[model samples]
Target: MTRRLSLFGATGSVGQSTLDLVRRDREAWRVGVLTANCDVQELARLAIEFRPDVAVVADESCYGYLKAALAGQGIECAAGAAALVEAAERRADLVMAAIVGTAGLAPTMTALAAGHDVALANKEALVSAGELMTAAARASGATILPVDSEHNAIFQCLAGGRIDQVRRIILTASGGPFRTMSAADMAAVTPAQAVAHPNWSMGAKISVDSATMMNKGLELIEAHHLFPVGLDRIEILVHPQSVIHSLVEYIDCSTLAQLGSPDMRIPIASALAWPQRMATPCAPLDLAAISRLDFEAPDEERFPATALCRAAIAAGGARPAQLNAANEVAVAAFLAGRISFPAIVDTVRRVVDAAEPAAPSSLQDIFSVDTASRAAALRFVEQYEHA
Candidate 1:
């Protein structure tokens, strides 16, 4: 049986990887919708090849180009944020919510509300609106399959087990490229250096998040929502090898882990074939060739983003949303050369600290907090830029 599929952020790293897996087993999926944010040409190229029922670009201005490119291809093309949400509501057996940042929240929620199974790769959706997103899933009977490698690992580890039996969920980090760098040395790092992850290939924003260990922090918050494990029981370990994706410990003192090469497709494939297995072109993990694996505690002093995220989730309410918003702004600033690498977390810390705690009850409230946080983060970024 062929599963109908809708893929958001079709031009991104995760989207490309998902498409790669789909390409290998083309007969297993019927492409319905594919979306990207302003990459009209690439989106058109993918739409033409995959021949999705419709292609959407989030940026409204790019609609003309996208439409023209897809003209006579028998694939409909649309643009703007509304189209993204509309596409998510389309009939599909599975929705791959791969759009990065908070922009993905609405469409993801739309899919869940429509009772579609969502393969979630966008951490910001859960990080920013965990309660609401989960509530929507519960009300609509939609399943949110974790697509992030760590959460997916825990998902696999907990198979046939109850959450109550779980004692701890250990998420592994690659420690990025600056695991051993001193604070002083890190302060002088460039965006290019920060994005050069040691083990995984990713977009610039997330790559920088790994450099500051913020990605792990965001994952921590994401894990809390996904696994329902107490935030206190969730821990982070710096595993430089990137072989062990994550671990879950049982109350009976047994630990279960999912090990794979540092390939995004591994997790994407996991979600794409939930309760079943799929084959990928990735090389088999050779334990002998990569003989040793090492683990260490994360250093919060040098990379305080992880700790900040813990505090935000602990505080609950608007803090995690604020933290995610500020971090997104700060990351954009760093990438644009508007602030120093160290200032990225510093700006996030300041903005999150200064934000007023409030429980966002609706998507509107979350966006309000996100908007306010971004403004505050930009102000802090400017202060750092001049200093």
Candidate 2:
């Protein structure tokens, strides 16, 4: 049986990895829709090869290029944000929501509303609008399969027992490239240094988040929504090897963990073929060759982002949305060399502290909060830039 697949963010790292797996078993998936932000060439190239029913680009300006590239390929092409959402509504067995940041939320919701099983790679969709997204999933009977490594690991480990029997979920982090750097030295870190993740290959934004451990922090908020595990029961541990993806403990104190190579494809494959398994070219884990795995408690004093995330989730209303919005602004500023490494979290702290918006009841409310939070964060970023 062939599963129809609609892949959003078709040119990204996760999208590429998903395509790699699909390419392995070409007969199993019939491509329906493939969307990208602005990478017209790569998107067009992938569309030509995969031959999706329709190709959509989020950037309207790139439509001409994409259309020209796909001309006469018998693949319909569309552009702009609305096209992306419309594409999400198209029929498919699985929708891979790989688009990064808050931009992914709407289409993801659309897919869920259409009752498509979503392989969610966008953390911001859940981080910014967990209740809204999950509510939509519940109302529509759409299953949200997590694609982040830690969340995916927990998702797999939880299969051993019921959610009620789970004691705690332990999310492991690589502690990133700056795991051992002193707080003093971290103040002077460059964007080049920050994006060089030691374990996984990822885009700039995520790599920087990993360096600050904010990625794990965001994952913490995401887990709270996905597992219904009380925020207190979920914890973060620094495991530099990245072998033990995540661990779930039951009432009996037994821990179940999912272990694999640090490749994103492992988790992607898991989501792509849920309730079943698919083979990937990824090398099997050689535990003995790895020599030893190390673990340590996350140092909150130096990496306070995780602590900030906990507070955001606990506050419960608009704070998580604010936290995500501010972090996005701050990360972009840090990458642009307009703020120091420490200033990233500092800006997030300031924005999240000041914002007291009402709880978001709808998608519009979430966007309103996001816009206000971004404005506040930008002010803080400006201060840091001039200081």
Candidate 3:
């Protein structure tokens, strides 16, 4: 069965990994559309390699560059957010949503609105507009497959059990590179040190989120949305090895885990094949040679971001949207050396505090809150820049 596919954010880490897997079995999938943000050259190169029906670059300024790169090819080319959203409606059997931030929220929802199954890699889509996206999926009978490793693990573990039979879910974190670093040391850390993840190869922003343990917090929020579990029932453990993707404990006391090498392809393939398994290039986990696996409780004092995430979840409504929007702006500022390490969460905390989180009944509401949060976060960054 040749599955028609569309990929949004086709130049990021997850997007590149997906392309590696697609290249491995290119004959098994049809490339309907491929989209990227400002990476015109890579997008055009991918267009040449895969010959997708349409290729879109999210930055409107890069349109001519992408168009010229693919000038002679029969593949249609487009640019800007609307073009990217339009690509989501191109009649693909599976849509891979790998766009990184709140910018991805709408396109992922649009894919669902167009009745496409989404292998979702964008946590912001759920973190910012979870109810909206999940509701859109249900209304359109669209399946949302978790592409994040931890959520994918829980999905794998829950294969046979009913939602009611679930007792708890445990998500493992690498504890990141700074799991043991003192808060004082973290405050003085550089962007170079922050993105140096001990376990996973990720983009700069997510790596810093991991450094602060906010990635796990955001994932906790994402888990609440993805799984049929409450925040109290969802837990995080500092698993330094990152070999155990995640765990599910049944009401009967059976804890089932999905174990594999730390590789995004594993989950991407799982979501792509789903119900039926698919092989990935990740090395098989060697249990005996490694000898042991260890887990510890997450240190919330050292990582207040976890507690803030819980607060956002408790606050509900537009608070999570604010959490995500503010965090994105904060992370970008940190990456650009405009904000210090600890100041990242301080920025997010300030924005969430100012939020009057009302339940959003529409995407317009989410975007409105998102816009305000970003504006507030930028103000915080600007103050930090001068101070």
**Residue pairs of candidate 3 with colliding backbone atoms:** none
Q: Best candidate, lDDT-wise?
A: 2
Candidate 2 segments exceeding 4 Å error? none
TM-score, candidate number 1 = 0.99
> Candidate 1 lDDT, tens digit per residue, 136-167?
99999999999999999999999947899999
The per-model lDDT (C-alpha) reads 0.93, 0.94, 0.91
RMSD of each: 0.8, 0.7, 0.9
Where's the lowest-lDDT run of ten residues in candidate 1?
351-360
User: What is the Å distance of residue 38 in model 1 from its true position?
Assistant: 0.6
Backbone-clash count (model 2): 0
Scanning candidate 2 in windows of ten residues, the lowest lDDT window is 352-361
